[model samples]
Target: MSDPIVPPILPREFGVYFALLEVSALVQHGVEGQLRRDGGLSFVQFQILAILGEDPSSPRSMTDLADRLVHSRSGLTYQVDRLEQAGLVARVPSEQDERGVNVTLTPTGAAVLARVLPGHADEVREVIVDALDGADRDELTRLLRQVARHLRSRPPRSARRAPTRSAEA
Candidate 1:
């Protein structure tokens, strides 16, 4: 096989790609480490727990949870299933929508999150917040949000409707 093309050579700010990779790896490592040591939750699992804990509405529809998680519906269902098996979450039928399922943290999940969150916050602060003073952090957040918004506005190739085939064909 031939070597893949290096990304940095591109004129556009491909720096974001490298930055995304680096930050993702670093954050994943820290969160995974903390979760393994303190709570036995993986990073994605922790994220789900944290989101549910933070939201006032404890139980939410699977589709709603997927949207909140930025995970595809199928992907979120798999994660939620794993969490359910782990005794960290419970999935119930949604009253508001019979077609939807509601996912909620179990008491076990809530207790675990309560125990782990302080240490998790510290790990986040150490790796992210503590690296920058408040002003720089604020500016960084603003700039990053603008970039994210720009990127999000661009539709994926799959999102565009395909041309219809004539019935005669």
Candidate 2:
């Protein structure tokens, strides 16, 4: 039997990939823990509040919020439902489109976000920014942005439909 062909990753490329994964996981864990403990919110819940807080005057559609957060539509809906129940966010039918729903941050949500942001910022600085000097941080940001842009331009593999088998023999 022939061995399957496998592409070899360059040593440097493999190291970069591993570093990115480890750093991302560690940072996310730290942030999630802080949010859960200090803010009484999950990371995703805090993210929703932050996004809504970005423009209190403007209510964002669910679809827009999902896209911005890179979340599935159904998942975003569930989060919004929970937030609504907690009085952190309110939902209203879109003025421009009756079929669409828009989410806005409530005063309570804004206050909670204001209260949590300081700790969140501190945690982020401790986990990531403070570890790097200013120049290295800027370079890292630029490089990561380039990589993100390239990745975002492509359709996600999960979004693609799989091939179907033919019925005719």
Candidate 3:
């Protein structure tokens, strides 16, 4: 419930933005070392696995993954390539769309996910969860989910139309 020491000129929304960014950066930095030590995975790679692991029986298309991650398809492809090389994920032709590719966590990927999850949970708990009381955590989660819902309702930055020149500029 306490506010971060945000600059006066930045205003309330900016304070929330900076605070969220700061917290995420810290949590990510805290786990970066552990993730490397345990799974030899980068944060994005872990995010990809974590997403796929959410429903191993279901597969996510590369385009779906790209939009979900707010990443470029090529960037995601490179990471998928690396994961593919590591035997962590498999890219199969989409049954619904032949040109589309679906990404799934392999058994090895699932095993790796299971192996790293405990430490990941512990690290997340220590860095972020432990910072708030139960009620505060609940409120935070609710507020974040609300904000996420609002944000997700909008089209992705890339999909939005760019403003056109008025010619009078």
Candidate 4:
């Protein structure tokens, strides 16, 4: 048999970081696959639906939804347009701000979410939660939250910190 191709062992500091990113991507793909094959929804689509479900009465502006999803305005518009065409959601002129538009999940969308959520929850448990024992899952949760907290404090890409002065200076 041919020798297996493997990446050179990464540095200790970066190893877990890279592995976490890879695992995150793979798990997202797995969830996406289940959504597509079983529920006919894309991951982004499901996220949008979940957000709407979170506050059905509140008018979710297109810009707000885009910001919440970290998507470009145009990309979000495209997704919302598709959802509108599918009759899953509707865009209404914002009563509070006529210049803006609000997206609302239709009854059909709500019904669909109600039907799909239980199955989706089970799939999530199977693909992620069930794979970990209780202790590990709790530890992962705590660690991930800590990482998220730290990440939120980092400066944006365009911002840079000034250099510290040396003691001699």
Model 2: lowest-lDDT 10 consecutive positions: 154-163
| lDDT by residue for model 2 (34-64), tens | 9888868888899999999999999998877
Local accuracy of candidate 4 as per-residue lDDT tens digits, 1-169: 9998765775775788888989889888878887777557888888888899998887698867876676667788898888888888899999889697899998887877776788788878987898899999999999999987787476432244457999999
User: Which digits, one per residue and each the tens of the lDDT, describe model 1 over residues 1-169?
Assistant: 9998785577456776788789979988987899889988888788889888876356877766665566666677788888899898998788888787788888888999999999999999989999899999999899889987886686533344567999999
lDDT of each: 0.81, 0.89, 0.90, 0.81
Model 1 local distance difference test score: 0.81
* Per-residue error (Å), model 2, residue 98: 1.2
Residue range with the least summed lDDT across 10 consecutive positions in model 3: 4-13
Which residue runs does candidate 2 get wrong by more than 4 Å?
1-5, 155-169
Comparing 1 with 2 on lDDT, the higher-scoring candidate is 2
Candidate 4 Cα outliers beyond 4 Å, as residue runs? 1-10, 153-169
| Tens-digit lDDT string for candidate 3 (32-148) | 878888999998899899999999999999878878887777798999999999999998889999788899999999998888889999999998899899999999999999998
Best by lDDT: 3
Ranking by TM-score: 2, 3, 1, 4
Better of 2 and 3 by TM-score: 2
Could you tell me which residue pairs clash in candidate 3?
Answer: none
Give RMSD (Å) of candidate 4 vs. truth: 8.3
Residue 135 lDDT (model 1): 97
C-alpha TM-score for every candidate: 0.79, 0.86, 0.85, 0.77
| Per-structure clash totals for the candidates | 0, 0, 0, 0
